[model samples]
Target: MEIKVIAFDADDTLWVNEPYFQNTEKKFCSLLEEFLPQHALSRELLKIEIENLPLYGYGIKGYILSMIEAALKVTDNNLTNEAIEKIIGYGKELLNEPIELLDNVEEVLQALQGPYRIVVATKGDLLDQERKLKKSGLSRYFHHIEIMSEKGEDDYLKLIKHLDILPNEFMMIGNSLKSDVIPVLNIGGHAIHVPYHTTWAHEQVEAKLDHENFRHVEHLKEVLGLMPV
Candidate 1:
């Protein structure tokens, strides 16, 4: 495969992301525990979050709204302003969370920087993603950064076109099989799935994918072995 552009997913793939969200979620669930059990509250929050995706897109800000909405729904709109403020505070904390680079992330970027056009292709709020990239200090390795609202085939097609590269000449490395791997493969590009320890329920898919241009690696550094020398 003549892969010219190598796009890496920012969250979880290059740095710690989901766990911070999960931590915030636990705080959220506990805050509303009087109205509902932790497990049920988690489900309600997840439901509201998924429902609000179309309107709010994906980000800490959306999550804060969802938490507030969930609290109101579960409490029959009896939620106090203090609780809502706390929810917003949780989101702010999440936004300020430090960027913890994953193991071998920098090393892998250093190794691939010269041979390929490296870029960040991820889905999240533009400002937040940019903040994380800036905090990560690995921004210099990337030739471009594409923070997408969605990772659908059409979205990726547009990105490939913007990069002036054919689908076959592009490759995506990410943690989500649903967003990062399947869509890229469907668009006739290469994909490598380096799964994180946890994944959002909405991003989970149940399919045994078998494709010629697909690979599953246990670690980010292993991608070096799969690259064409």
Candidate 2:
């Protein structure tokens, strides 16, 4: 009840993200379906993504690289120049996507803004996250923005230090349990999981949680009732 900072994860939490990526994945699978079945290519792309996470980090650029790599594998290095161009086009489309804020995002932020030192603590390419935040028009609500390379306990600890808030005095709201909830909970911060309709395979986690500081909400609107007005 004494939380001083409320940090939100940017991607799916604030705006539509995974669904766009899912659609792009479908386009990708279709593009290479002749080289391999849709299901197989999808799995292969995920495998490459997870494998490439360290080198490329996270975001559209990494996803594009994985797609190109998968295409090469599926077609045995015989992928057409046109196909490569199309894949690059997919990445460009994702990068140029309009920010569509999730339901109640601005409303809830408006409600909580005065009471909380709101911030964005999200993981992605800095340029891309900054671009999305700029497009969302919600940047003014946040006191600070932390675009992380990764979200782990240490990262949250560093953020708490930067913000000069105790772990117990910080709360994180996000769509990914793996990236958002677990790390905050592990660091003794509060977290609420606001599940999105679609999730990337990399962000999925099993639901057997045992942390007292963690809560799950059916929607962003429900989060309003958890604190004072």
How much is the lDDT of residue 217 in candidate 1?
96
Q: List model 1 lDDT by residue over 149-210, tens digit each.
A: 99999999999999999999999999999999999999999999999999988899898888
Candidate 2: the clashing residue pairs are: none
Q: Provide the clashing-pair count of each candidate structure.
A: 0, 0
lDDT of each: 0.93, 0.93
- Per-residue accuracy of model 2 over 119-224 as CA lDDT, tens digit each: 9999889899999999899999999999998999999999999999899999999999999999899989999999998899888888788788998998998999
Q: Considering every candidate listed, which one attains the maximal TM-score?
A: 1
196: Cα error in model 2, Å: 0.6
The positional error of residue 160 in candidate 2, measured at the CA in angstroms, is 0.5
Query: Model 2 scores what on Cα lDDT?
Result: 0.93
- State which candidate has the highest lDDT: 1
TM-score of each: 0.98, 0.98
